[model samples]
Target chain A: MHIATRMKTRTQGGITEVLVLVNHPMDTGLVKSPITHKIIPAHFIKTLTIAINHKPAVITDMGIAVSKDPLIAVKLKGAKSGDLVSVDWIDNEGMTGHAETHVS
Target chain B: MNLPRRTFLKQAFSGTALAVAAGAGLLRPTQALARTWPTWPAQSFHIKHWRDLEHSLFGSKPVVSGGVHLHAPLEAENGAVVPMVISTKLAAPKRLALAVDHNPYALATLVNLTPHALGFFNVRIKMGKTSRVRAYVETADRVHTVDRLVKVTIGGCGG
Candidate 1:
């Protein structure tokens, strides 16, 4: 129910690179619980949006095939060092996570 | 210092460019973002075959073409977490997707890039077995794609 995110940004020349790591089980529904020995329900981020300075730059539609603790990177052409890079994601179960940081 | 460019972007998002796209019915009405963002291609993810996935996502099978690059290991030591990077050489890449031919669900991820962003992405995915991984990029009128074979030593789907 609770998702944690970490974001790092770097700017060189005129491009700003943003990398985000999201905390999630990314269960494939085929994976069985080690304790219960039952197939875990599918739980993964479905829609992830990256915004640069409040303008949506990239949107990712993901599935259970993504690795656990998903790491995503995006590049913005005109984003500068002080621009704000934000990430917002919603999972299949309707849970959401948000994190933002200034590009550095 | 950034106020002028920020103001221009604000104007573009609020009134001119995106609004025109929406007014021209180019943007999907179902998107909750109230902008030109693409709706999740839910059916594409459920497909199991490469041909079907291409059909479901793009309406037809795109010919294997250049300009789209997929960076993945020739042999993935661990199927649980295989790092992949995809980029396009086209001037304007509208949509990009990655699919694994052998996985139960072939579609890995779909990306829609706005005008402000570049056509490059880095992520990791799970593979069921040794399979052909394909990356597709869509331009205004053409869809370019490329694929690579990634051998998984241990399958990742069975837990």
Candidate 2:
């Protein structure tokens, strides 16, 4: 789970918006190795869960259709600067990544 | 820190088991929100053709309409990340989904908009080749669609 994620949270008019960007190859398993010319096995993030103050808000199950290093943006009820927002994801390979932040 | 090698293997194995359960249609999400916001069937993600995807998502079939607008490039330099935006004149769109005709799996992102959020969504997605990118939008009662063709000079499916 060597995922590097960046999150920015902003609140306006009782609405909190969180933007999350993840770093992953998102390998589709459709491309071939230039040298070996073999179809790489399909491996991509299968599920992503987002929580506001530890309450699940957004849950996404993605496949190879997602681009490499996917972007996920979520909107929820407004939270104070110290409120917690977290994102957790598990890929098709079963590797998982988690990150959390307090609103700025 | 990354997980230990043994733990990684264990997680991977369990993931495979979960996938198998999903494949058997036993891996349904228990949350109420997911139930309200529609999601594609687990296997439908691998559909190779756009028409099949339409049938799966739209129930009957999606009609070509001008109610929605797709903002995407006529040509993309990097197939790995082709930027796109979607908007609709239709009143209060509830969900938006993207599908690539030429990609190995046609269905891409399926976005469910919160009631408070406006019906505008922007995303950067992968293109396997030069293909038609279709956007499907669901409103209160019906679904509307529009598509744009983009040329990918460089392939992005992992080669």
Candidate 3:
């Protein structure tokens, strides 16, 4: 599966707002396929990492309850223009995706 | 010359072995020590009720307070995509977590933030039905909680 990630950052008054959207199915394994009537194996992002200027800022450990195509936002203090904000996530199936953007 | 080449090969092999070990979940020194990633609470998330989730995560009942703000719609048109935002003016919160009272799994997401980061976050969650969603903000001394009741028009969990 080709997982896609997009990140956006905006800095104002020393606080940078970071928004990230990751493309993932986030199946809970409890749901069954409509046509096949088979249980869909659980596939979701277990861990998500956010970094500012290559330094770890926030680490989110998620469960199956999180929505599909997860959209996460966090605010960073003391961030400035041109600071790099990056996001990475690993799913239950060992798949990973990464995206980075600079604060504007 | 031969001795130096052999030493270089040995060092390179050991480095590769270390990388493999880390990938296999054997050694995670940096992650454990530097807070690069917090361990997922699989057992806590498996709890199905509000009390059980609270006991597992906080070791006691957290105090319900207005210090934490939970922003969510009174009625979610789609249970599959319920937007939730949590923010607090509390100082240097160590952790933030969410739980859905009526879902099969109570615990939704837990975030570990560094001291420098703000105590605010926004995310989307799924609701099996109309349920109460709770957010917990843990500081050094206390665990503050806030909950909101949301009516879901359609169930999110498909069978």
What residue runs in model 3 are displaced by over 4 Å at the alpha carbon?
A: B1-36, B60-62
> Candidate 2 on A1-104: residue-level lDDT in tens?
47787777777887777787889778777678788988877777776666677666655567687887888765665467788887777677656666788876
The DockQ figures for the candidates are 0.41, 0.34, 0.55
TM-score, per-candidate, Cα-based:
0.84, 0.73, 0.85
If ranked by TM-score, best first, what sequence of candidates would result?
3, 1, 2
Writing each residue's lDDT as its tens digit, candidate 3 over A1-104 gives 69889988877788888999998999999998998989999999998888887777888989999999999999889887787788878778877777888878
How far off is residue B19 in model 2, in Å?
Answer: 26
lDDT digits (tens) for residues B127-149 of candidate 3 = 99999999999887778999999
TM-score of 3: 0.85
- On DockQ, the candidate that comes out on top is 3
Instruction: Rate residue A9 of model 1 by lDDT.
Output: 88
The DockQ-based CAPRI class assigned to model 3 is medium
Better of 2 and 3 by lDDT: 3
